[model samples]
Target: MRLSRSFLPTLKENPAEAQITSHRLMLRAGLIRQTAAGIYAWLPAGLRVLRNIADIVREEQDAVGAQELLMPTLQSAELWKRSGRYDAYGPEMLRIRDRHERDMLYGPTNEEMITDLFGQIIKSYKELPQVLYHIQWKFRDEVRPRFGVMRGREFYMKDAYSFDLDHDSSVDTYRRMMLAYLRTFQRLGVRAIPMRADTGPIGGELSHEFLILAPTGESGVFFDSALEEQDWLGEDVDIHDRGSLEKFFTGMTSFYAATDEMHDAEAWAKVPAERQREGRGIEVGHIFNFGRKYTESMDITVSGPDGAPLYPEMGSYGIGVSRLVAAIIEASHDEGGIIWPETVAPFRAVIINLKSGDSTCDALCEKLYAAAPEHFLYDDRAERAGAKFADADLMGHPWQLIVGPRGAKEGKVEIKNRRTGERTEATPEDALALVMKTQG
Candidate 1:
């Protein structure tokens, strides 16, 4: 994408309303704009990042046997009423009335709706073990929606629902989701620790929140450092194998980790002081094993092996797709700007034309840009070198391929690593080769 042709609206000064690093940087970098108090219009650059994150999330979910489907943002209020939560869910629920005066709402979550859908279609135990997921926008009326997308009232979310006929099978689904979450976060270049958490309105006895540690996090967390060292994707556990999944689950839970609400002094004392780690963390994902909470309330049932009516045990897993954009920034930004993880960066590298009109610089920049037009952001704007460098750093492409008049004339260009701030001089072909190698 050419900077001159793009709609990026980067600002020189931070927005006063942005209190956190992610919020301030998001505004200054032109990733998003606030349309209303907690609602944002994701600009072109921001939308690219959001889609990248969602794609990774979708792939991980699909790998774990979860089938993707589209769910509507607006839902009939009758479903929540049947689940006995229409009234229980407080002001956060945006209650509305249609032309006929029928009640409706923008769904904050999809538990009751999904339960009803399953009850209608799944009548026998043969369809007992199914995982269904959707990536969609959700709305919650946060009294104080601040910190950009971190606590936004309107955001994109990926919510998955698992249905099983028995308690053991349901727990297995939960364990599988836990492993999936670990893999997803690892791929996103953040170390997210799974800590025991309150179920909140979800109403589950067993729940885990994947918290990415950041200084600006809202949750205070205590954990064992060993949790951060586990390579989930490297482990030889098959997602379809029950025993393998159980073993992996046990290994992960063996670590001492708890949110402030679930902290136990006795458990904390058991850990060696050197291995204990405490920090503020932002929640990126959550999974719940609520068993029959929704099924029982909504009378969702299927026939058991014995042909008896049974309420299917269920679990819900959620990853904040939009919030992750901000979370990733919070966890991995420096003074200059966001240092995006290559896996989710909008572009793998940015090509900066340091001397735009110079024949040599233009030729070199055009060559590099054409080599991988889709994977590179070509800064063809007629701007000063300083402004070009600042915008490239602020946008946080993983690499900066610099073409200056002198370097271009000498058939040499500079390749700078965004995260490490390391620069190396290379020919245009060598630089393209390096970027391709990183992509591979």
Candidate 2:
């Protein structure tokens, strides 16, 4: 993307309405714009980041054998009514009457709807176990929606539902999703700790929420650092193998991790003094094992091997796809701006032309960008070098290839590492090679 032609509207001052770092930075950096209270229109750069996150989520889910299928944003109210939750869901749910006076809702979650959909397809135990997922927009009418995408009324989410024939198998599915969540966060270049959580309206005894550490987080967290040190991406396990899953579950749960709501002093004291860690955490994902809750409520059942009707044990897993963009910023940003991870950055590196109109400088910037046009953002605008530098830092691409008349005359490109603030001079070819290698 060229700065001259791109829709990046960066700001010199923070927006007064943005109360959080991620919110303020997102608006000032031109990644998103507020279209309504608690709702936003993702600009080009923001949409690119969202897609990168969704892709990582999809890859991890697919690795665990979950098939993707999109469900609708508006769900029939009858689905909730059948489960006796229409009245219990409260004001957060946007209930409406369609043209025919039929009750409908902008879905906050898809438990009831997915249960009803799956029930319509499988009538027997032959279709016992299945994991289905979709990445879609969801809405909840929060009375006070704040913190930009972090607590937005409308946001993108990846929600998955698992169906199994028995309780033990359902628990295994839950474990599989736990691993998937770990791997997903790992690939996003963030460490998320899984802590036991209370399942709010979802209704499940077994639940866990993945929280990324950040000073601006909403929850106080206590845990051993060991939980964040695991290499989930390197783990080898068969999803269908019970023994392998049991070991994986035990390894993950062995660490003491909890939010303030679930903290235990006795357990905290058991850890070595040096190993104890305390911080604030923002929730990015959650998983629940609510066996038979939706299936029984919605009469979702299949014939058993013995020819008896049986309700399938179920679980639900969710990742805040859009919220993660903010959560990652919370966890990773510095005073300058958001230090994006290479894998999720809109562009891996940005080519800043310090002397835009100078013949040598322009030629060098063009040569550097042309080397990896798709992966580079060229600052082709005729702006002052100071403003270009400020915006480059504010946008936070991983690498900054700085070109100037002096260095360009000598065939040298100055490279700046965004994360480390390290600057070095090299030929255009060497600069491109370094950035591309680091991107990999």
lDDT of 1 by residue, 272-345 (tens): 99999998999999999999999999998999999999998999999999999999999999989999998889
- Model 1: weakest 10-residue lDDT segment is 228-237
TM-score against truth, every candidate:
0.98, 0.97
Best by TM-score: 1
Find the 10 residues in a row with the least total lDDT in model 2. 228-237
**Candidate 1 deviates by what RMSD?**
1.0
Residue runs of model 2 more than 4 Å from their true location after superposition? 230-233
Query: What's the distance in Å from true for residue 336, model 2?
Result: 1.0
- Candidates' RMSD to native: 1.0, 1.3
In model 1, the Cα lDDT at residue 79 comes to: 98
Clashes of 1: 0
Residues 1-440, model 2: lDDT tens digits: 78899998999999999999999999999999999999999999999899999999999999999999999999999999999999999999999999999999999999988898899998999887999999999999999999999999999999999999999999999998998898889889998899999898899799999999999999999998887666544447777789988888888888899999999999999988888999999999999999999999998889999999999999999999999999999988888899999999999999999887898898888888888888899999999999988888998899999998889999999999999999999988888889999663
